[model samples]
Target: MIQHIRISRQLIFVNKILFVFSLFGLIGAPHTHNIRAKRYFFPLFIAIDGSFTEVKVNEWKGAASNNRNQEEDGSAFIVEILKNLGADLVDSVEYGDDELTQILLSEIKDVWRRIVNNPKSLVNSGETPESLGIYMAKILFIAKDRHCESPDETFINGKCFPISTRERSEHCPENMGLYDDEKNEGFCECLELTKEKAKSELRPIYSNETGVCYRQNTQGPCENGEWFVLKNTYPRCEPVPDGCPTDGRHVFWNPDNSTAKQCWEIWTRGPCDKGQLLHLEQDSTEEPQVYCSYRLAESFFTYSALSFPPCPPGTLSNYVGQCIGCSRGCYGAFIG
Candidate 1:
């Protein structure tokens, strides 16, 4: 009978421990859900008092307040938040109070979407919703405290600028001037003397490594059998490919045609006028023909060999010489 009583006490103690664990689980579950719900409804919980309040999923009333003063104050607060997030809503004056509130809400929703999509950005799991909103605002908008990974890069105007750490005098070699804008931005560029020389004679490509401008198609610093060529605006010594002219006139074969076995002069006006380069034309029926065409800016140098004209204002040229129309509802000029 005594052993039976002891067993009953032991059972009661085990039951009590189980009940305590169940109670703790019930308390912890709500807290976990509350944190998740706050993140999930971050856009809806944007309060005017700079505090985050729990918002029900079904309780999103449209921004339609009877009090004009209260609505304007709320709109102003939202505008301030957006401006702090790097949003330049310069045309806000064009929108009415109701329209502007809707736009601001849309912008807030966009920010919330970004935060929700980026899981790795949630560094602090225990951060309050208000603090998280502020943290995410900095991340999505201004990025003022963003860390630059590159050793040669510096943060400027909420963006990364590839500025050198060398002295101003040593930034560029002789004959190259440092083009510094009113801002603290600068880059090594060829001076007027160098530019005139390049235009009169063969164009010289600037070398970032040696800080010297070397004439194209020449053995400036290259080893024997290799010539200095501008490979995508970068000065590099590359061997002359087979079947290409060794006289430094022809650099690459026509990218449009592999079977044509024809090579073209890249920068220099070979078999063309001073302002033109030799261009290739290949139609489905007609035989391949070559003609003199005006050279475009360095940005279009890769497309120099093609015979197609530049795309129209609202279109862009693809690699295969086809003009693709811009997507519907797109604004601004689309240039190559």
Candidate 2:
């Protein structure tokens, strides 16, 4: 009986030790790369207002009949990862499987041609063509963040600042209001004026005031409105879509930024209820310019007037773009 009891105790002790070792083995083992076997693309953009927008791109593996469901699922998985990485809004842009194969191949051939012609472009020392290809493949799989001459402090390590604070920069443009919160305290944002203020204080009229329309009780977008008065401080209208002959593009001073930056005239698509206006091209060399270049609070966006519903504090938008109460709770809330 004593021997049996001792045997049972020894077995129990051994089992405990085995269990601990197994647990450690599982924890310290290298993670399998099943999901990573597929290629993917992710582009993260930081808006001037300090909002983080991530574009989750689907994988393109040079197979014509690639799976749509797989692409979508991978994109969704990436968006979830981005949200966990402090993304404010996540959107997906997908292409058909193998859709970009031709384009990429053409670009690669072009690069190769350039290298063959100018051998100096391909450093002969320590860098082989295969090594260059590897680096290029890495770029396609995981792109590096784009650098700017001046980056806002709110952006760090491909994520927006987590903390929220209220501080204003003395450098805000004239007539533009300054708003700052903890997460974006380091960004510079001009205040949006209310319609009432636009009408009363900074009364604006079209460049051709011959028949300028006016509404006594009309309001300007204090926040979340589509149209913003070009110049907030000294409100005045310059000949735009209707006023200009639409023959040629011209440059004018923007009213929002107190700085001296000349804004160029841009044409808009027929999305305008009126009609699409034409403009003279300044340079065909620059990327094909389009109309409706309205100034955004940030220099990053030009003439985007889309608006979504403003959700209350402590809530976030659902996958369907509807505002819902946050499950994890909101740390701070402000209109961007």
Candidate 3:
């Protein structure tokens, strides 16, 4: 009888404990719960191209440059952007060995992991997902963010937006909305430049959906009363205008690098009227000319935070910003 009573008491106690645990889990256990640390693994390519083999990197930037701290600032800026855009920005930064290369690699890895990798991998499979191996098969060096200034400082070419006005954590004014950051002045200035450039010409090159044609140069007078000319192409317009068949590429692109003979396509045909984007392809590789792939036509450099696509040689496209050729082709992932 005593044994039976003891067993009953013990079972009751066990049931009570289990019930309490269930309640805690439902109500207040989160306050006491410990979160498991997320492990991030850089791809072999990023690991090898970057100066580190680990997920973390250190910048011995105690006195390297004024913008040394800005690297972290940039990372933090990115973190906020990613989070606001609903990303899994749960990892804290880790440093391997304090160096510029390490900082660049680490910061870039931090950003890329969030942007490129799916959150399901980090959540369900942890760091060693099979899909990761596909991308990490080998480390390839891409100069996506490797453009560094001389041995003195950091130079971020395409970052000219105004700084943040808010004091939120990791939030910078630069990433804040355009209307909020007092960037309207700069945007207004850009508009003025465009207006002046467009007003100088009586008839500029007009790119139809299919190909680039010109505003028709009337032989004598237009049947329509409007001042606009009918559309013309390479042979038809070449003799009429001083440089009629204007290097079709040069019509849209005003290349600043001089070496860039590519066209940057601008957006047009709307209230938006994005002019054109400049695309260039300068293959400096030793590979035979006959074996280049089609992906080579998508290299792009940022003239601003907005992206510009690049094109390979013999490919034609409109110019958007200052045009230039790169030593190699850029890899672009179109979000099809």
Candidate 4:
């Protein structure tokens, strides 16, 4: 009887060990998800000031589309490195089915106004809707912050520093490095505007005033509702990078960062959009310039892929073009 009891005890011990080891193998093993999502949102500034004045995009806003299909842009050569980074989680592999890039229309509208009145003010490398709004708040910070009695100089990064003539160097054009620095990630210093500080206007009423339109018909864009306004800042527009295609036959993709090239095609049926505005030439020597809207954010985007470029912190794993961000509410929650 004692011997039988000993055998039973040994069996229980072995079984418990085996069960725990199995749990580790199953729970700790890497899981893979195939995702579909968008990576970019086109900023469209609409004047809520109430007037017959329709925000017109003189460049490609209302232009006819023979080449650029608004909805058909599911796959092209365009890509997003950050969206591709979502799959790099511990014990996880993200597939095209697991890839996604999303933006909230509400959030997009909330910050869209900032770029409207200040054409030069744009969402550069990492500007999201919330980030832009946060920056805007700083601009209007004094109006809200009773303790603070001045207009603050906010950096593209959201750092707020005192506004001073000597501090003029703090402006990005004066210091281009600050534009790309992660450390400058907040509003700049403040300036003592008067008790009645005016917010940036919605749209410049006159050409001589301070407003310009913002247009984007290029590679890597997926969302629309492009906006415009009268900007007060000098140079009043984001300078298109010289590398921007002045000439080429390039494809685009979906905003979701979907990379299925088969989904994109060059239609010979009619005229394309970009060419109509940029006055593109098709001479073999003149290289065809094309701004692809959607494609794999990464060259090897999920065709036996490993990981995506990192999404901003607090993003969700969802459909292509579908994601959640902490700053922009990528998954849709305002943490602060």
Candidate 5:
């Protein structure tokens, strides 16, 4: 019995040793594989301020400490080398802090050496003492943070503006006025006839109501309103629709003819005076349906000035003041 007990204890000790070795093997395999893979996996480009720039990691050898001139200090030498390699360091002082600058200055020599040897490894491993790869990443993050986060926004004159504003400014000439956002349809427009301009040159007349330019005696692009006519010696959209009353009323026009028009009160008994109120359907494919029904709290109502409700979550208002749904698959939000 004593011999058997001793043999059992020896077997237990051997099992524990085997378990430890197995655990270590499982953990070290991936680490060994990563080290081997990193040798030839350096990034060819770096992203900065929403743009990609080509980077040559092999050229980092020239920035090593041994290559510095005797007259130049470490920081100065590294800065000069980076400038020679096409680094945009002019805005570095504006973006970088003192702590980061001091940290880079103190350990730049070691960091550059690590980068020169294996840039991919230093970047992937998140090395201490802040490798050059890490510094560049931080710089890139700072630069991106300073600009706008929305895709619909554009950086202009050190400020963020809506993309529609930029598009209008760029596409529209000085003689032509900006097209109405709701009816722009990705096209520039001529100036409105109401605005006074030099009469030496004949230009196309723009209509604010129809959002179209009309030539002399031409029909223009009117689909619901009156045809184009020469009014006051200029081709213009005639018989403009009258404005609706401010007390929850909207313009009701005949879709078939458009000449017969009137202002109708919303959410009230009108043509159907039997105790039903007018209701307009939302997201209708056919003509806007205005039917008589009992008013409900869930029904949508609009004022004469056309006040829009707040946009739902994950959606934003566009240049035309219409709520647009955000894309689900993309990383950022954009207005269409």
Candidate 6:
């Protein structure tokens, strides 16, 4: 009878413990939905040739560039790249209010594992996890942040906008606009260099949605309205106006070397425009004359792509092929 009473007491204690655990489960357990939401992977659009293609996050893990610290650094860099391409990254993800967890390497890997288990989380299911972590991070970032208005339109702030149109023959300048091809909707954006300009500092110039800056010849005005032509048509405008386009496969040269000094010498003679990017091609990999050509035209460089090394540490090869130094308080950076 005494043993029976002890067993009953023990049972009661176990029941109490179980009751406490059940209560904790009800009140303190992590939300499965929140975990799923955190695991949700987003699609990233990559412009291939002239069209944009959807890339999954797992696939991007293989392609992302590793930092000096052996961590995925390309994610943050790609974010800046997207901003330069003209979309509000923070606002697009709805994370302006919440601190973004995916930006960190731990979360990046964690989300990747979840995505591997459920391929349906990606827009493209067949993609394999390659060395595309940076690319994947960027894709996931945009996917998580992009705010869609309807099935057809994307929302920015309170307004709805269209998706990006077809890729143009030329890369758009900072003074120009770009559309969001990620949504496959129409969302053209232009740089507002004059956004903060005071009324006194501004001029009444005719601006249009195209964002093309036209230069009038002004040679006594023909039947046409002042014989204006695209600034790009001139030989002087041959160099990329908005800096070099970032393809995933760019190799940057060290500007501090002797080879770079030779390139600087060429830059000094030509008086290249500030921020112009020149591409030099070579047949033999070793000690070949690095012919300088404009980044815009994809065609193989002929005589025009001259043999020059590279600009010095403090300078950038500009549009006119001149070595332009960085302003005071600023450091020269090579974006390869």
In order, candidate lDDTs are 0.38, 0.27, 0.25, 0.23, 0.34, 0.29
Task: Identify the runs in model 6 with alpha carbons over 4 angstroms from their true place.
Answer: 1-125, 128-144, 149-160, 167-178, 181-225, 231-336
**For every model in order, what is the number of clashing pairs?**
0, 18, 40, 81, 0, 28
Question: Candidate 1 clashing pairs?
Answer: none
TM-score of each: 0.29, 0.18, 0.19, 0.15, 0.25, 0.21
Q: Against the true structure, whose lDDT is highest?
A: 1
Arranged by TM-score, best first: 1, 5, 6, 3, 2, 4
Per-residue lDDT for 1-336 in model 2, tens only? 865554343333322222222222321235542222112111111112222222111112212113223323332222222122111111000222142333233333333333333334443234444454344333222211112111122343454432221222344333222322322233322222232222112122121222221211122322221122333322232334323222223333333456553444344322223453323211101222223322221221222112223221222333222233233332442212
**Which model is ahead, 4 or 6, in terms of TM-score?**
6
lDDT of 5 by residue, 1-336 (tens): 865554343333322222222222321347664453233121211212322212321222222324333213322333333322213222333434343233233233333433344323332233432334345434333434224433334445555444442122454553233322221122244432211111111224444454444332233554444444434433444443465432213435332453465555555565655766666543211222456566553333232212233322222345323433333111221111
For candidate 1, the per-residue lDDT at 169 reads 32
**Model 5: pairs clashing at backbone N, Cα or C within 3 Å:** none
Q: Give the per-residue Cα lDDT of candidate 2 at 328.
A: 33
Candidate 2: global Cα-lDDT? 0.27
- Lowest summed lDDT over 10 consecutive residues: which window, candidate 5? 193-202
The superposed Cα distance between candidate 3 and the true structure at residue 170, in angstroms, equals: 31
- Sort every candidate by lDDT, greatest first: 1, 5, 6, 2, 3, 4
lDDT of 1 by residue, 78-181 (tens): 22232333332222222223333344434444444433334333333344334554544343222222234332343455655554312233555643434322
